[model samples]
Target: MNDHLVILIRSFSAFFILMIIGRILGKQTLSNMNFHEFVTAVILGAMAANFAFNEKIEVIHLLIALSVFTITSYVLAKLFLKFRSFKMWTEGTPTVLIEGGLILEDNLKKNNMTLDSLNQQLREKDIFNVEEVEYALLEINGKLSAQKKKELQAVTLKDLQLNAGNAPQFPIELVIDGQLLHGNLDSNHISESWMNSQLKARGKKLEDVFYAVKGSNGQLYVDDYKDNIQHPIDME
Candidate 1:
């Protein structure tokens, strides 16, 4: 009958029931879940909490409530899988935020998202200026899909009118966390002697290195110590 005991019981029961339901519903239910799914989760949690720890509330009552929710979720998931229209109706389509560097104010207003929020999302993608984006979509899962302007995009060697004989090589790390990775060395067709020589150049021993990676270009990148450490030697 203790309030604290009831709260704890409800918390554990909610998690246990929701986890079971989620597993049966599939991973996509959590990953690409829509607004409806999110609401269902909250409702399930509230219902579970009402009975979980209350001494007057029996386990049978909690089981019945949990079962009903799980069954409803399962039915909806099945219906979504069976009907494309149902899926579309439940999970809204992506909304265009910007097209051709022009903000779609109508679509933004329809989604109840402001221009400031769009700009903030753009900044998160390393796009400080709105003019630099060619396309941006607000995904149903709340992810921003953005495309950089043509001039801002990376240019390949061919774009520069340059011809190369061979593809640039990348290095493979033979050791990490003081453990030797012979498989990586073999994949890169590099030998132990070559790795030792590369380490010697930096005056760093394999044991001293925190991590090391070899590039396809046969270049060795060694980090003997942690980064972001302000040491006098690092400043120099």
Candidate 2:
């Protein structure tokens, strides 16, 4: 078989197989995926991509591999639904961060959560006062669910009758996946030379950066592709 022809055939096959697999798997959108679902989707995509491009691997082998993994994932999902303990084990239970307007220091420390991070999440929800939050939970999906104090629930910005001096500014991404976002940089009046100097100071090149964003505080937060963490958490 011609190599190009073989590649084209494999690509088509992979595409159709993925469509079938997705239908079998049901609705799991990228926006609201849990950790296990994210892992499963990534692995399946990698496998399919490898199968499509790597001609050394036989077509039948790829089919068998996909079938095995698909069945395994399906079985595990069914198990997760059937047993409460199993579901909790696979997908962690919600963590309580605040109770009765008081921060739970012990719970925060155990989850490796900082006050700054908690405050940031709260700020995103337009909540400025921790005392106003009667209860706050860190959901399993990494979303913050907070309830305001009964007295504060009806209070509005109009009632305060105070000038909130400055509005919060969202962070702008200057670089993502080693690609420079030209518009973001231009809007911020950030020069490439300055960005290069910043990267050099950190002993990193542009290609080494996974994400680089200018924060509301006017600080350039650069995260590199290599996460040199001594202990990385993995549920599975």
Candidate 3:
């Protein structure tokens, strides 16, 4: 066999093995992975890369390394779920960075975060001033959670003492990529004849629609396949 062919085979083999392991580990591993989980992913990726391109390394050795790391991560996740104390120790607790319109400098320093960095994170959440925040917490995953002061919060209809007749229902996706979603239509109490009539009124056929949804206001929103604009301009 050619050397290039052998390399290609090994690369593909490593890719498929990683995919299979990822599937077994489940979605949580990819979403919001904690410290141990992040380390495990990095190690597995390194081992897979070595297995893919390194001709001198044994494939079985790489496989064993990957398996051990994944299993340890899985066991730790399960333990964390079953025991609160273990979870708190492993994942750490949410640190209060701000309370009652005051910044907790001690807590911020403990998390190795500077005042400038904290202010930047606050700005990202649309809060330019720390005085506007009533509460702010640094989550275990390194994300900032913040709550604005009562006076600074957005006003709602209830605050104005006004009764808005009915709450809007969630829009139902009736069609996607020219395919009719019969089940969605049935559940939303929309008839096929009504859908056909709406399409006809707009001079459109079912196949012409790229996406369609029935809004809470009883209006049909649609995007067609045809590009109506002669010249496209980038808004961004």
The candidate scoring highest on lDDT is 3
Clashing pairs in 2: none
Which model, 1 or 2, shows the larger TM-score?
1
* Candidate 3 lDDT over residue span 76-106, tens digit each: 8888765656887978988889877789999
Candidate 2, run of 10 with poorest lDDT:
162-171
lDDT of each: 0.75, 0.80, 0.84
Pairs that collide, model 3: none
Which of the numbered candidates is closest to the native, going by highest TM-score?
3
Q: Compared to the true structure, candidate 2 yields what TM-score?
A: 0.56
lDDT, candidate 1, 40-64, per-residue tens = 7887777776666556777787788
In Å, residue 209's CA in model 1 sits off its true spot by 50
What lDDT score goes with residue 196 in model 2?
89
Off by over 4 Å in 3: 158-236
Better of 2 and 3 by lDDT: 3
lDDT of 3 at 25: 82
